[model samples]
Target: MLRRVREGLHRWPAVARLVAIAALLLVAAAAHLAARSEPAGRWLPLLVVAVVGALVAGAPRHRWPLPAIWLVATVLAVTRGSAVDPGATAAALGVGAVALVAALTADVVPVLRTRHRRGER
Candidate 1:
């Protein structure tokens, strides 16, 4: 299933990535709105930032460290806030896990570099 998803996205290149990023942003917005009781104005910017970071790091040429930095910063900000609702836990966990995996290895960077190099040739 995961392989199929990856392959399907790979078939369309930038379009697929853009759609995926947009969907991720939508999800973030929805999650933020649903999970937190605070004013939308407060968390909307953070949601936007998260989406922007995800989009920037969505490409094959982007290093995992870039996204990792964004994720770390976001997590710190979220935690520092006075209240954290349980509903946002899924997004936090999922993205956090991805960032952790990226931080622990050079997998994403090397794969992207190789693909980029091949494309250049």
Candidate 2:
């Protein structure tokens, strides 16, 4: 069973990446909601940061960064933003900005590497 799951992930890495990101987003959303009325709610934004960071770190090498960024941004906006109340708006925006910056970095790093390689030739 474990071997089959690993093989499936290897065969469809992009799908696996999307699913992983989606799962993280869901966890973040749930954390945001659960902590909303608690004293620990202030710390929930960190969870958002962690989720976006994980997504960026695990971004697929061969896929465009836009889809993952878009999914995270949209999910954060809907789940962490005003849908819950004004309280979550700040966390949503902050996390969204982080995700955007990470996306830019993901796109830029490969291009820079390719350019450097060509220059060496």
Candidate 3:
């Protein structure tokens, strides 16, 4: 069973990323709704679009940057503007940004090492 799980992970990094992003987005969306004073204007719709944009780009090779970019945007918007509930946006966006950066960096480092190994051989 363990072996099977490992193989599945190897074959589907994208799925892992997709699931992670979806989970984070759920938390953010819920928080956005639950906040005592979320914006009454366009922030809700923008947040929705950001979540969907991340979802649509959830490929391991490509979507690696999507969540990070989304999170940064969210963070900036929250910090600079008075749209969404800052605390809720900060929590979800912070975690999502960090996780995506780590995952994508780890993924790329391995490829670079493998290429160097081939060159040496």
Question: Which candidate achieves the best TM-score against the true structure?
Answer: 2
lDDT of 1 by residue, 54-115 (tens): 44434424445444544554455466574766546446556656865775566667678889
The runs of at least 3 residues in candidate 1 whose Cα sits more than 4 Å from the true structure, single-residue gaps closed, are: 1-60, 99-121
Give the candidate order by descending TM-score: 2, 3, 1
Q: Which candidate is the best by lDDT?
A: 3
What's the number of clashes in each of the models?
0, 0, 0
Across residues 1-90, which tens digit of lDDT does each residue of candidate 3 receive? 645654565578787566556645653554344332455353456555555544444434554554555565555556655656656666
The C-alpha TM-scores of every prediction are: 0.33, 0.45, 0.43
User: Which ranges of candidate 3 are over 4 A from the true structure?
Assistant: 1-58
List model 2 lDDT by residue over 1-121, tens digit each.
6456545666886876765666456545544453343344554564555455445444444333433444455455456445444455455445556766776687789899999999999
Model-by-model lDDT, in order?
Answer: 0.55, 0.54, 0.57
Where's the lowest-lDDT run of ten residues in candidate 2? 62-71
Q: Choose 1 or 3, whichever is better by lDDT.
A: 3
